[model samples]
Target: MRIHHHIGRRTRSGLLAGLLAATSALAMGIAVAQPGTAEAAASLRSLADAKGRDIGFALDPNRLSESPYKQIADAEFNLVVAENAMKWEVTEPNRNQFSFGQGDAVVNYAVGSNKKVYGHTLVWHNQMPGWTSNLSGSDLLAAMKNHIAGVAGHYKGKVFAWDVVNEAFADGGSGGRRDSILQQRIGNSWIEEAFRAARAADPDAKLCINDYSTDGINAKSTAIYNLVKDFKSRGVPIDCVGFQAHLIIGQVPGDMQANLQRFTDLGVDVRVTELDIRMSTPANSSKLATQAADYKKVMNICLAVARCQGVTVWGITDKYSWIPGTFPGEGAALIWDENYAPKPAYQAVAEALGSGTTPTTPAPTTPVPTTPVPTTPAPTTPAPTTPAPNGSCTVTYVPNSWGNGFTAEIRIRNDGPDPVNAWSFGFYFTAGQQVTNAWNATVSQSGTQVLARNASYNGAVAVGGTVSFGFQGTHTGSNPSPTSFTFNGKVCANG
Candidate 1:
């Protein structure tokens, strides 16, 4: 999910200056609250724990030596995924000859910090050495099985999960399987073989099929959905699905929750793996705000799905984000900024995790009975007919705009005499603006009309209580706000 790159070392002066500023602020009787500090009270790790989810970051072992990086990694996250150490090239670059030095370092760090380790991958086409590509037929098959056994067996009980096969499906079109060396040499059966081998090596660890660009109900995701469905029917030992949510600003998929739900409905856990929202840098306030909303949307999506286990950001800080190198002019992709300071995205993520409802239903140990796939696809938009009026409410809309995009915070208050247990707030966007993503609710747009429903955790509102959610959207020429709103199909007063 990430391209490995070496970051130039930073001098100690930045850390020194940060400490000096904190000290000065403290001496002047000003409060300086830093993430993972007592003054902050809540951390991403602690918040995630309360929600029964793991907050994780991809760790670069090289950066573990730095005090600030180590501190943040230890204090803010409860799960650790190696950025490059566990990949094919790093662990088994020269055929049967293997090395586990760097991988061990990462595992040791995770164990020392009491964080769970999620192995990056066992079978991937891109990171394999040139020798792998040269072999075909039985020779290649043997090598792959051996590699899986060796690597998965080594980490046996140490890792909680393993990405048994990564990025095997191609993007675009019908989302056919990728024509990787493994695919061509061992044929389509290679994927099943790899999973079987991994299970043999580590019976306890959860095995997953990880892929990118499948965060929504697109061609690629549908392909993965069919694969998982097939795997379940044939009992192919897949315990989880990983959606590598490498997204762009104002472009988080609106159907992310629905997509993840469909996977979990198949009786396997789902995870947001290698998540980072990138934007063209030097990050300005507006871009950063939109980025924050995007991050919260992703977190909320994961939280909304009962079987979604956790979310792991690609990296801890923007300084080492792979975006800059892999994507020209796109650098600020992580929650933490380059100076090791928390950005708005960090705060938004923390809040979302903290407010999310803990799932009550446990993941199914045995595969649930499968239902026949409907020949007709489900409608993406809600029903056109409005529901009968149920209650009275009021809505407050606040928007922040930059260029053609904007982020809005909406507050809906219960004005009726009785408390509203579950509600849906609706509005019309008159300016041809379209919502890209939202958080604290499940938001969907059908043309100019948009509907926002309460998430699991925030469904109940007291007689006078209020529920708030935010979204990011785009507009072409005139960005006009919705003049009217509805709550549970009844027209609500504008605030």
Candidate 2:
């Protein structure tokens, strides 16, 4: 489900549990529970791993020739994709041929480190052994059956996911060329056969249908969606739809995130498979800058969605890019350069991941308060300016279906044990998902801040009445929870 040149480093950029601070370090035999987390349910949501990134390579065992495999073994990627190493030819060359040397190496490496392994595919048109092209009817089905059973059964529970079907829909339309064996020999039903056979082999692995030219909302993408939709309706056992974003330098498909969300809304997980940014030529400065922007945008979109679980870069470096050898006149589509040094795009990715400190965008700003007007007459004594109350609010914010925004309610309490004038709370959301609605609180979004107005309930909370401040806002890349929630000049613990 992914493509790449050789092994190189594309430095890249997911979620984690609620970021709770440890007031004190662990002092032998002591543990502290994080507050505000929902209690563990009998069957918890899989949102824990709902975000990730990928690693892959071409059809070569010599990927180690580029550098010590340890280089990638130490990276921050969440998953590793064994590109062509698992294909029919490489995995099974002759009759009953089962060569898992290269593929096993990658899998073992990933497993040893507790990372996820997404089986490249059980069926693919290219890289298939030449002998397969001549098979027909029963022979074809038997061949496919053996292929799926052998590979899927071999890995089984060890795999986190499987690319059961790849490139099933073609950009040229008509479900791809009629001559393609998958269509010609067994017809489109082969896809279902492959999935069913794979499930029979390994019921635990999440099965996905991966394809290129379907990363955006296009004809081919639509066709694939309908197929998957119908299959799911009929209990076909499909779990996710993979978007192959083998993008150009600056042309990442639009509506890619929303497209993924729609599929997620259908109750299927979504992933970005075989992601890469190919330039007109390698080492082009302008192209590299654009590639940086492209990488940032890709990470931003994935971070903006809740069900987008994984994103695997086609490969790590541009030096070994599949573009030059595969497409000719195009290459340099990765994060690392020939020297294995990080590229600008790589650094941008690190920043997007929150480990790097390069400021790609401005920081969110807080709204300013208004000052009292002066009296020109100077005759009457100026009335004393009212002071805001020293109250606090409890806001339980839940990120929405899309990672772009969240919803919450802030409950105000008179912490100072004294009645005061009003309560005002303000904070900034980098993307400003916007405040859809609010009550007992006036809200507005500008630049990146959410300004809320809260007057004492019943003109003053009567030394006991309470006011609440709460609203939702869109989230951008690499940001943690909002740190600025205040009521009457005092910051709330969690806002």
Choose the strongest candidate by TM-score.
1
Residue 131's lDDT within candidate 1 is 81
Which pairs of residues clash in candidate 1, taking residues 3 or more apart in a chain or in different chains? none
* Root-mean-square deviation of candidate 1: 18.1
Best by lDDT: 1
RMSD of 2: 17.8
Estimate, for each residue in 352-455, the C-alpha lDDT of model 2 and write its tens digit.
55433221110112111111112122122322332342344444343432344343445454555566565566665433344544433456555445567642
Angstrom error of the Cα, residue 78, model 1: value is 0.4
Tell me the tens digit of each residue's lDDT in model 1 across 359-434: 1110112111111111222233533544434557888887766567665768788887877777898887766677
The residue ranges of model 1 lying beyond 4 angstroms of the native Cα positions read: 1-38, 355-495
lDDT of each model, Cα atoms only? 0.74, 0.58
Candidate 2 off by > 4 Å: 1-61, 65-69, 173-178, 356-495
Pairs that collide in candidate 2 are 9-316, 10-316, 10-335, 50-309, 54-312, 433-474
Candidate 1's displacement at residue 377, Å, is: 61
Name the weakest run of 10 consecutive residues (lDDT summed) in model 2.
37-46
